[model samples]
Target: MELSQEELRKKFTDLSQNPFQQTKFSRNTKIRKIIKEFANFSQEKLRLENKAVKIAGRIINRIRRFGELTFADLADQSGVVQLKVVRNKDFARVSSGDIIGITGKICKTDLQEEKNKQELSIEIEEFIVLAKCQQTLPDTAHYKLKDTEERFRKRYLDLLVNTENRDILITRHKIIQSIRQFLDQKEFIEIETPILVSEASGAQAKPFITRHNKLHRDFHLRIATEIPLKKLLVGGFEKVYEIGRIFRNEGIDARHNPEFTTIEVYQAYENSEHMMNLTEKLLHYLAKEILKKEEFEFNSHNISLKENFRKMSMIAAIKEHINLDFSQVNNLEQALELAKKHNLRLEKFQKSIGQVILAFFEEYVEKKLVQPTFIYDYPIEVSPLAKNKAENKDIADRFELYIGGLEFANGYSELNDPIEQKKRFEEQTKQKELGNEEIASFDKEFLEALEYGMPPAGGLGIGIDRLIMLFTEQNSIKEVIAFPQLKSKTEEK
Candidate 1:
């Protein structure tokens, strides 16, 4: 039942006399600690002798009789404890949705069962209204706030009611913590980089544009952390890493968000091979530490982290799945013919044979990677920033880790040749001019940094949100994010 304005006003009036607006209150113990310190709950005593403790939390559940007795569960982020109150004017007006501060003594019921004996209860000596909630909570044994449109729009209430969502959020924090610990042990220094840039050029994705009024110029939210981290590499920061928010103006789906977080790591004098080994060890550590097992479930698929991640070239994967070898096709005409045979859609900007090979792999081979797999040796046409192989100029030293048919990480051996890098940027600029909306503009400053002599480096970018999804067994990226992007209510209507 929703609370009317008049009903809410009455609640406020009842709480007004207690404490008008206090700056601070004393809290001697948390609910979890109280339960931990007093484990022997079988005592017949009504109160802990000489033990006066103060606690505060929202009242979650209640059972009451008018001016006789009241029992309610007080819940904090740590845990919940039962409150025993003999009805009085002070706390008899207390409701389930209110936040209350309690000065209490610990006690236990005389129930003989071991399970009942373990339950700790608190006897309240004083009650003060911390905050009076205005609106009625929209949750019950049958109805849930999750069924309403306001769930994601108002996430604080959702966290209060949804146990699984709360667990997913807590798991996310631990996942990032474990990642930082892993990288720190490897001697990787974490750095902060600018979010606003003149041009976004690290990846092939459209950027969100914003304007600066003072300068009367435009800037873009960074689409990737690759460029600036590499500039740090050129400046003699041999090993650096950054985990920050990245923005891309793109379509939203189960795995994609406009603004998300990524961790990009760059190590001088390392190659894609070193990155692969690091990726394997990092993921295995996260699984063992966070999930507490090498095996977990995602979208009903059993993902085994123990197995050595299968490795195959992009071309090999395509040939295995679709039985078509792009290496055998030398021209765009032959590649286009093979694409048609496999029913692949062609974009106007995808005019080259290598581009067609990438399209075929995305359309046919990605979904086949149900297990943890690495698709390596990408074509140079798609991997503009990766170094080309010495023996074959057509393939770049890049690998992407895929699990549950989703791309989780992309890593590459650094392309240190200034002249070759400039050529690649020029080609990308030409493509942008030809109306490739997803292409980034040529970054002259980044090119200048490369000209200053960057060392051979290995770089990797991992989507922190998606990794959380995998660990928490959530199917959608929104489940892991606290406040996911949602269309406005008017747009929804």
Candidate 2:
């Protein structure tokens, strides 16, 4: 029988005001560890049944009643276990989702074997309601939280009901753990950089801004960990990395989020080639060792991390995809003509040959890079922080790893020359004046850091969220992120 609102409120108030003592459950074993310790639950391998166990978890199912006998499934983070209680009036008051503490013993079920499968369960001796779940739970047959927006909005309920989604988060934790292990084994020191900064000059992206009350000036959330991490190279750290949150004020899409995670690694005395190799090794290690799979299906493409990733220059990729040779384009006029021919939108500042090539690459080549690939030598106009190629000054010595048509990692040969870096920053500011709204500020402090004889280093940045999405085979970025930013109530209309 369903209880009235007043009755439910009174029951919860009484329980909260006079709860039972739970001192015995202070040392309760996790459900997962308990299952593992007593390996087999079969009648033949019941192992030692002498020891009593204390366990605590929320009742996640309807308390099945057969006369005086009661059965419920208790769940904790480790996993779930069955509970068997007989002739207990206290257990009768508890409903699904109510947290309970139980003192029990591992015992084989008295139920007859159905196709040779009888279960092991915990037979409760003592019990306490740790907390009461006031509201009634959804019927077990229709427990899934089906609305996508609702799932994201009320993530706690989603995780509580959907075990599969919860496991995705678990796998995300494992992937991050594996990354730390891999980097630690390679002798990389993990360091923390500031989330708020005076200048957001790392990557070519807009930043979220907030005011500092004491300083009386605005600060920007870091769009990338590139600048401060590279400053560590200036501070004499040989191999340094940072794994933290990055904020970008951009349009949220299937792959983009306002706040996301990135792992930026910089190694002194190394160039883009070395970082490229490290990126490949890291991904390979994660696939072959961590995930234990050489091939994964993402976006309907079977991406293979087994072989050495294919490498191509930006111009080469454009030529291959659109069959237009950027190398043959001699002047800005010719580039503009090509842009017009291809129906590419070019702002006033983006009329340069380099920007035109970048526009072409994005429109033509990115989606076709369905397998593991390293597209290097990005356009100099678009790569302000990356070093320009010695042979081709118009191209930056940079590489971006792509899999299943999405960019996974970006690495480059760092520019140690203070004069060139200063020039790049100045040019970025100038570009902003000419209608390129997304450009880095002229960071005088970072330029000063570069002037102190920083080592020629290789720097790499990988979007940790996107990597998790790829590994977990989730199409949308919101699926992997725990609490993705959503549209406001006002905007929904």
CA-lDDT, candidates in order: 0.85, 0.85
TM-score for each prediction?
0.94, 0.94
Give a tens-digit lDDT track for model 2, residues 368-437: 9998899999988788888889998988999999899999999999988999988888888888998766
RMSD of each: 2.4, 2.4
State the weakest 10-residue window (summed lDDT) of model 2. Answer: 16-25
RMSD of 1: 2.4
Candidate 1, residue 212: how far the Cα is off, in Å: 0.8
- Residue 226 alpha-carbon offset, candidate 2, angstroms: 1.3
- The local distance difference test score of model 2 is 0.85
Worst 10 residues of 1 by lDDT: 109-118
